[model samples]
Target chain A: MMRWTLKSLGTQIASTLASAGGVAGAFLFVLFLEAVFLGESKQIVAYIEHMEPDIWVMQHGVSNMHMASSFVWDWKLDAVVEMDGVEKVTSILYVNTMVRAGDRDWFTYVVGLVEGDKRAGPWAMKSGSASPGPGEIVIPALFAESSGAGLGSSVSVADKKFTVVGLSLGTFSMANSVAFVSFGDLVNILSAGGTVSYGLVDLEPGSDAAAMARRIEAEVEKVSALPHPEFVRNDFNMAMRMGVDVVAFMRVIGSALAVAIIAFTALVQVSRRRRELAIAKALGVTNRSIYFSVVLQTVLITTAGYAVALALALGVAPMISLFVPEVTLLVSTGSLLRMGAVALVVAVIAAMVPAYMVNQVDPLTAFQG
Target chain B: MASSKLIRADGVSKHFGTGHTQVRAVDGVSLKIGYGELVLIMGPSGSGKTTLLSMLGGLLRPTQGRIEVAGTEITVMKEAELPDVRARLVGFVFQSFNLMEALTVEENILFPAQLIPGGIAAARPRARELIERLNLRERRDSLPKTLSGGEKQRVAIARALINEPPLILADEPTGNLDSRTGQEVMMILFDITRDENRSVVLVTHDPRVEEIADRILWLEDGKLRDRKSEDHSWVRDPVCGMRIDEWTAVHTWERSDSKYVFCSARCKERFVEAPDQYVNA
Candidate 1:
């Protein structure tokens, strides 16, 4: 049996590895792109970790806080700050803006962090100072690199210029670079009578986020507060649901291509071994054995292909990160096993018809040619 | 033929297709091949030589006859038991040298052993011995595609012999080879039959094959026409054992008032040594 398996291994290498490598290469690239999208979302969540907010208050009917409108009176923050178990309450005003540095402009998001609120400040600083005063701003390192701007340089946003006091590391949202400034500066730019887009509430230790969220929703309904956490979660869920649509489309396309490739592989393998299969039958090898041999070959080939694809993903992960920062191609052993199981199923599905053809081959035809 | 014959075919018939379109490939053929005999079935194309061989080897179930191989009635055996009978009692050599291209020569030779009941360990030494005897040890590691026509046939022969089957069935075994290589292959096959006390039933369109057979069963139009024993003066063409009629043969030599006929000069030269051995009293 070992000898048979070893011979089968050699047959797989000689016949299927080249084509499998090509297919695996294409699959690796697509998987890498998907990993980048997931990694980007993860990085966005990591960037805002210091806020430590138990509940986020956003506008009603808003789909995503980053891409929707949310405005509440400035007085709402004071009301939230007085709520029991609420350690602190701060408002964040964020909007998309085009920032100009050295005669070139790049699109970015301008986020307003309240002064003296350490919970909402830039999490990591690569250079300069994180303490941006009124009229000063913190820009992401990617923006600094692309714009060729440095410390003390001035960046113009909404026809107003601000000094770049600090450089923040790895702060990006959906591929857009971000800039941070004081809440007062943001209020002045928006010209909205000091109304804020969102209220960030930091809860006391041991407070349940879900419980606080329900209380906050009730309070907001009584006072008609604009931004609510339940609504925010609903909006987050909706936007993520859209992201799921895109993921599903990607999966469909990947699966279709994988099926075609595997089918072609099975076809070629069966055609090549038709004579051998006939001879086997002539020599009293059972139809079941012939079927198994072809199926086994398909399984072995697809498994090797999937393994090569995983290795390619791991090999190119760091290189991909170099081009698209914060994007890491991560495949756990569980993921590998899942992919292998999927490939095996795909292989069997692909090999079924061809294996039947092998079983039907007339042993007497072996005498003809 | 005795009831204990190694192979017995009683009223065997094979038909292809359905109803009006049916073609009788083998029609009502009954014959017996005894133990330790070299029998040749000779016929033209479409004469059911191969069809008969298929039934005799248990590769095909005759549509209407009781066939027995090694005392086991194959017509009554289930499909699952066919492989067991084939592995235990019958070995087949195909005309086209159907060696697995992916496997090495040695691997192809040992394929039958791998398919048998026991592990390949029992067949390894025999395979090695056959390989060395056939002068294929040097090319054992080479793939079938790389070997010459003769070497490929030798590999197929060794594969057929690996299981030590009692009955050897070969269908036009030398049809694809040149005369010289075919002679070498025939010698090896005949040597195997003589040394192992095995029975050989070879089907061929080539008349030369009849010379080496102890008996020749002539098939024509899906039926057996004659079973004739040839005189020893007919030199068995080493390429294929076709018995040439000494009176009308083109290649012939006289010895002791009897003329020995050959299909080719090569066989005549091969028979020159110990001519008395091939001559009838």
Candidate 2:
């Protein structure tokens, strides 16, 4: 039987892997951008959802927590507790601002609540407690290290100084660190009295959280309430939506880059076999049949590149977090698949130019001495 | 169309461009070849030898008139249908020993079998037979690049015969080989023609091959003519006394407005180093 493929099986595999290396470079660039851009939302959503509150009530007209602020009077908590399905209500003062520690400043999401409250406390800690005493603060260990402060060290938030009593993990992201301080201390810092940023509600057994949410919104004059999953989804979408236009624009740019890479590789591969292709054409191999092999090679290259990109992205995230602790990468399955689809599109488009070149090839070229 | 005839061209013409830039590559040429005939098409450079061969083999569509290979009028066939016709009935051999670089001798021989019914597997016995018949049994597993010139041409002939094509169109089949190897390749082609009853249409400028051809068609200025029985203008190299077909000669030098053609680059170089001696001779 005729050997219809590459010189040998090893040559075909080596060619795919070698071409994938070039394709993988393009995948890596786009994946890295996604990690840096959406990394914060990934960490923040994970941190919040881990607390697992039944419902959250923001100040009136606020649908999400990221990049937005809300204020609810402390009396709103009173009104919520009196509702039909009310179990308990807890409050936290939230602010997104830069915290100055010594001479350096780091942007942070500051959460202020009573001591021993887990409703909006650090989900994980490296040292000390989530319940920082009044006049004390809990900062992500990563942020603390960068600020050159650790447990028992002094730090300042919103220009008010507090002793660092706890170091947290899973609270540091690419954009900002989540820092905690006492509710009264935050109130003193903000100089606002008798009001909190948001109210967290827990449902009693057999209570419909969504219905309770609707009731809270209806009874309370100035408030927006949402179920736990809904709140988490909203915050994730909003936080990640910060530079969405850029994300969309980068997606186009990245896709174009991938197309060019694959196209260039396909073109080079086809060009090397000009004589062979012409011979095949003269020998009665239809252009369509030839394209089957070309496209197969391109798709293999693209898929192999995706596998390489996934490995590199996953492998690099932890290394990056280890070396540069401030930056975390979120290589989600959804986005990876999206990029993979883009790779497929790139593979198809890449095959076109070379395939056209093949179509234009004069089979008479085989006769060229 | 006649069943006894393997190829018949009815006033076929191929023009390159329209209007002033037009090149009348083959202008209204007509011919017929019976089965088991070995005909040679010889011409000067740009004489449309390849173009005519391309049309006859269905590798090209004539701009005017018709070409019939076996019983089918190929010129009128749809573009997509021509490839199957060519694969089923026509086999091609080239001067470059156009064996696929990536394919082994046996693999190259069986390359066209993919288009036939039952595919390459069905043609394996024929491939082995051709390999043994062409004296390539030991080299069946060797790639074209690893083979000598004569071996490559033998592989090309074996490949041409693998599909059992009734007509073989060879463009300068022996142009790149030394005289001895060229004669060996020509012998194989003649053997295929006589023994298998296949017709061979070959285009070449090598005058040394004229002795073996059953009939010779001389092409010049885009049309066949009976001006000279000699295939093409033949010139002998002063350095080696080897005759070179001046039309397709790649090793040539122009001095004092006179051209010198050599059979090989070394002879050309020797002449170039001392042009006066050869010119005087």
Candidate 3:
């Protein structure tokens, strides 16, 4: 029986792969896109590690990075630091700056962290040293690679020349590339000598984050205290609002197409095997056995097809990454399990229609000349 | 009395369609086939011989009346239970052979036996025995499509005997074979019935089959007439010496003071030319 099942699986693989190449191609493409865009490569949480702030304080009406605007007075940090349960508070400046490396210039978000604060500065520096002195800068790896500039190289941003002193691991954000700079330097760049963009607050161990946020919001009326949880939620919301969820959409479409392909294949197979099924029924095979065999055949086929697709996807991952530099194909155990579950569901649904046909087959007609 | 008849049908009528358009396929068949009897049902086309066989085999339910095969009234059995009854008591061979093309000869033979109440482990030896008895062991693993007409018919016979059912229902089991092959198949079927004490109800339009039957039933227009019981009423052709029934022969002759008959014109001519020489000299 296993040999027969294997033969059936082989036939199913050949037939489905021959006729429904588009579905398989599309499924692999979706997996490739997921690896590149939404997978570990686009680490939103990792970028936030540089701030190291237990709480963020933005303007009262600010929602996301691009959609909302906020600029609290620089003096607000002093009052925030004196609040009960406040450990320390420092000012952070964020601005979009275009840096020129060689002849080509690209846009990136220059984030300002306080000097001498290891918890809040260039957390994932890959090369060179962190805490770039007054005129030095830390560029993300993607910008450095694209701009063809490395450590000790001079780059210009906003007409201010600075030497590239280090490289960070995480590259671009969903919105833009992030470059770490000193808060004092950013103050000079944004104000030409004035207040910063937002405040970064660290709370004591026993502090209630929500209550602290409310108190901070009440105290600093001009700006709002954005909790860490809300900040993460806003980040995801912004990504969704900007149509950066292409990976998720591709996954859905791939799943639907896989189901359709399996269903159509099962239907065609059942139609072809109608006579054989009828003969089996006439020969006294019970209705239950016929149904079970049809479903078993479908599940066996789908399992084999999914295996082939997964192997092919893994083989082409590097090629996909090379062709589409922005995307990476990360085939983790979790993703494979997800794909297997999807294929199993598709197999069951696909087999149901044909199994129903088998159940309805009249055994008497099988004996007819 | 006669070991309580293996099959008993009472006023079994099967009608197709409705109202004025109703056609009675097996109008009202009431017959009993006892154990170890090979009964041949002979009729012309559209004479309802196949329908009667189907009713006897539990393949079709009679429109009205009871059918008892192997002590179970099939008419009272539910649709779900019909297959079990058929598998346990009746093994059917169709005119078309009805073998699963995808399965091998051995698999087809083992199919019915495996589906019976017991497990396949209990049925495997029986299936092997039947396969060997039918001389199909050499081609057991070969698919039905690769077998010749005669070989396929023999496989079908093996399948019918696999479960060791008390009764065998054959609908033109040799309909597609040549005369020699047909004779060989009939010989095997009759030998099985006589040797194994199994009852057989064979449905056919050909009168040549009447030779092997213990009792010959004549059906005309969905009704059974009386049984024919004349000894030596059918004879082998002198030229080829193949058994031919008197009703279907091109020429038939009867001997004086004896009801015995000879098959063809040539055989009768030869017998008449030298009466004493051919008779008893």
Error in Å for residue A280 of model 3: 1.9
- DockQ head-to-head 2 vs 3, winner: 2
Candidate 2 structure quality by residue, lDDT tens digits, A54-157: 99998888887777788889898889988887888988898888887767788788889777777778878899988988899988888888768888888877
Tens digit per residue, CA lDDT, model 3, A224-290 = 7877777766765564445446666777788777767767777777676677666666666677776
* Candidate 3: pairs in clash: A35-A328, A36-A327, A36-A328
How many Å off is the CA of B212 in candidate 1?
Answer: 4.0
Each candidate: how many clashes?
A: 11, 0, 3
TM-scores of all candidate predictions against the true structure: 0.81, 0.89, 0.76
Give stretches of model 3 more than 4 Å off. A1-13, A16-37, A50-70, A79-90, A95-108, A113-169, A173-175, A180-195, A198-252, A312-319, A329-339, B1-3, B19-21, B205-208, B226-281
**Interface RMSD per candidate:** 2.0, 2.1, 2.9
* Number of the top DockQ candidate: 2
Best by lDDT: 2
TM-score of B-chain for each predicted structure, in order: 0.80, 0.88, 0.81
- The better candidate by TM-score, 2 or 3, is 2
Native A-B contact fraction in model 3: 0.34
lDDT by residue (tens digit), candidate 3, B1-281: 33389999999998999999999888788898999999998766678888888778777889998999878888998888877877778888877888766678887787777676675678888878888888888998998879988899898888888888899988887666656677788888899899999999997644566767988887778999875455234555543466666553434455676543343333456666776665564
> Which candidate tops TM-score?
2
DockQ of 2: 0.53
What DockQ does each listed candidate score?
A: 0.46, 0.53, 0.28
